[model samples]
Target chain A: MSSGLALISIFVLAVFVGFEVVSKVSSTLHTPLMSGANAIHGVILVGAIIVASHSDNTLQLTLSLLAIVLATINMVGGFVVTDRMLEMFKVKKKPASSDTSGEVK
Target chain B: MSRDLYDLIGLVAAICFILALKGLSHPKTARRGNLIGAAGATIATLVVFFYGDQLPLKNLPLILGAIVVGLVIGVPAARKVQLTQMPQLVALFNGVGGGAAALVAIVEYLKLGEEAAEKAGAIGAAVLIATIFTVVVGTTSFTGSIVTFLKLQELMTTRPVIFPGGRFVIAGNLVAILVCSGWVYSAADTTSVMVLMGLSALFGILFVLPVGGADVPIVISLLNAFTGLTVAASGYVLEATLLIVAGTLVGASGTILTRLMAEAMGRSLFGTLFGAFTATATAAGTADTRPVKSGSAEDVAILLNYARRVVIVPGFGLAVAQAQHTVRELADLLTAKGIDVAYGIHPVAGRMPGHMNVLLAEANVPYDQLVEMDEINPTFPQTDVSIVIGANDVVNPAAKTTPGCPIYGMPILDVQQSGNIIFLKRSMRPGFAGIENELLYDPKTTLLFGDAKASLTKVVSALKSL
Candidate 1:
């Protein structure tokens, strides 16, 4: 197969994988899940870096640099915020289980 | 690094992303999953630098400085942002990501210049089309996310902004965007591309304008998908397999999530966007002086103290009033009194789907007590007093009873089914959808008009007195 065809195959498979992964998520996790996925696309940082390194002129360099900054924010901030949100869920787990335990007993 | 090594690392990062999404689906593994994704992102970023031949290390210092600046700005904002404001913050992050994708595409397009047209075949056309897709969709996502941010942040009106011939105006803008995209495809000129970007930005703003407050999260999710597809297109343009995989994953997942959220709200995606056009203008400003049985906090306290079962239905108002902690205190007090208390959480309770859960969880409200709509709806009929704090739209009976209203057909918490209902509201004003809830005036309902926090505080003190 040609290189383009290989890329197309990869793209199609990835789409299916993406849909399959998050298909069964419960409603409560929707916010953090969306935020987490939002951060994943922050991998655009790699694209930004490539464009920045390829820049030959001042304007090109400026734009690419700006892209890098934005992409970094998306990636770094997205993960951190998602982690923060998930942390709330983490802390509540033990206490929540204990609270329910009393009733179970 | 060898090309083979770089590609292998990219593949690893792609797998990590898939794992991250899978891990995020459940509460037990969510934080660890996010951490794994972060580690993958860190690895991918670090490896890009070592891939020597393709990446000339010329702009290394500048790029490092930019990344540091991004870290400085991004980390603190993520860390410091209140949970209540998280929806807008997510919108902001999504916007900047879209902006970055668009900029990368523009830079690549500039670098290609006339050489792009020299490649005389289908590959050339494909690359050009990908570049155009990245530019248009990325720009639209960037601006659309910003509009949603403004609406959520209350920097602008959250109501649907429709005007005379608004639909025609939006349709014309879309047509103009398509024409410009075609123009850029034919000419590959910078001017046409620039015009296309501007039109796409305008189209984004106009597209999001007609969507009401309750529907903004869906729009955000859709724009998020748009950004993802743009990244995928840029990845194709840049010949980077990692981008293609990651971007397509988010695009596909975001699309599905958007659909799920729309379903939870009982809205078709089509009706949410274009329903404004078909909707007849309801007379909004006529002050309804209809007598609601207004009671003091003491009266509400007496009602709650005697109830055997109570369900708290919270909305965006609860978040706005910063009353989650106070409400939790009240719930705990009622539990002390042997009243069975459970929170009835609407899926689209706050600005985003599952927003209320995040807000409530921050206040350390137990997860088991936070019941989903379907599980909790059946129990509302058996509950005694349902305390609605700072929430309006999610519990509005009009969602089920009134056709042609903005929230018509949306699933609401069956709060009206409770034996008695007490609303702690700021005023008699309508909900975020701009529709007055008929349930507020029903005889079974009692209104305590004040700030949710203050009203709850009074009720707590009154319950103490009892």
Candidate 2:
């Protein structure tokens, strides 16, 4: 019961933290922010691994392995694609700076 | 490693996730933030191998192989997907994650087996309920995301799919799902659980089918939250603190984003999800075939060449025609002629929020020139020409003028206030919302009919020659 209460406290605090962190995001980064959050939840890969390690039967093992593969894709693909999107934002910034510097010269 | 050490590492990974989300909120810190998240994920995954003695060394090879296969598939797809297709790709990734959570819960349930039924007292019941919630919600998120993906990818009709009695049918499906969920709770039987999963999957498809294309982003955000809650539930069932924190965080954040997106589109969350049921079905193909003022690419070039100020309104169609580069070329030519130009980006411009910014960024458009809706709205009145590239709904005057219409209350780009409105269009088709744009027929508006890319290219050449 004490552990459950601890878990509940964690859940409540996390919710508050989640809202607080993303509440001020400008609309310009909405898509990347979303994609990044999507990747973070892919930490369910840990849950998948825990289950897979404990499976005693063929069916259980197969299911756990499948979960691992899917979770991996969610975590990995999500981060990579988010990075790709953010990369474009980064590349454009450099040229704008250079053009400003050129103007100064 | 000691159990305490593993948990400490997990907590670190969770903090990294919090930082990642915080970092993503700002453009300057976003890339680094994502890197931090990736690093945290790497830490969590590596620590799992050394945590306790639960993982048999024999199963290690299979686990590694599965992860390798996932990497082989996930990395290349992420790397190679077109910017235009990013929304659907994100939806697909989210769907697979939901499926994985469901599978993990199911495997855990199977492992618990009949023994779980005996301990149907408080804690065991809680675990069983959490497991059931994970299965139902995770499956719904998985299937619902796939439907959203199909809509965005244009593999399925982007319009709302409403049958004669869709509301009733959807309601019936929901009731059936609840009933099945109850059965699973009482019996704790494998068949009951499977039935609940199947019902939830059906409910997911039915739930999303009524949502129109414009509202698909909201649906995606909602499903992401659903997946997050499922992960949280599965965490409870498995007693993993990391999953609980990460999942609850995502669930909370995703809910906020969904609300923000819906608000941006001037839509209520409830209305977006269930508007099809309450509204009367307006007839399709009632397009007023009024003769619009069509102009040539040369004429558009002359107008743009002479204009002192221009604002380019971009939409989903710009991305569809892959005209970002061509449009940028036109803008550059206009800028060279001493005409000030800026892109007016609607919040929900493309398939997703900020999608147009990404597409435009890919074409190397200066960030300063990409003005947001609120910041750009007042400038439209003073602008000489507003070139709407393959966009319809965002600039449509009907949003402000016509009440009791689908998009009446939605805030729009006031391109109508410009000296001249020029639309680059392929045809007279209504936009994704299936509503006629009255601004297209305004006397001051000139239509250039062709693929946006081709039309922009012609305009560029014409302006250069002049």
Q: DockQ numbers for every candidate?
A: 0.64, 0.55
lDDT of 1 by residue, A1-105 (tens): 988788889889989998898888787788898999899899999999888888889988999999999999999999999998887766645544335311211
What tens-digit string does per-residue lDDT give for candidate 2 at B210-301? 99888898999989988999999999988899999999999999999888888888889998898877878654447596889999999998
Q: Over the stretch B1-466, how does candidate 1's per-residue lDDT look in tens digits?
A: 7889899999999889989989998888898889888988898898888876654577999999999999999999999998889988999999999999999998888778745567643337778889988998999889999999999998998899999988888889988988887888787667888898898898889888889999988888888888888899899999899999999999999999888888889999999989888889754445777888989999999999998889999988898899999999999999898788899899988888888888998888987788888888888778889999878889988788778888889998999889999998998888888888888779999999988998899999999999
Off by over 4 Å in 2: A92-105, B54-58, B117-123, B283-285
List each model's interface RMSD: 2.3, 3.3
Candidate 1 deviant stretches above 4 angstroms = A92-105, B54-56, B114-123, B282-286
Tell me the docking grade of candidate 2.
Answer: medium
Q: For every model shown, what is its TM-score relative to the native structure?
A: 0.96, 0.96
Clashing pairs in 2: none
lDDT measured at residue B424 in model 2 versus the true structure, 0 to 100:
92
Predicted candidate 2 versus true structure: per-residue lDDT over A1-105, tens digit per residue: 589888889999999999998897777788998899899889899999888888778988999999999999999999999999998667645445333211101
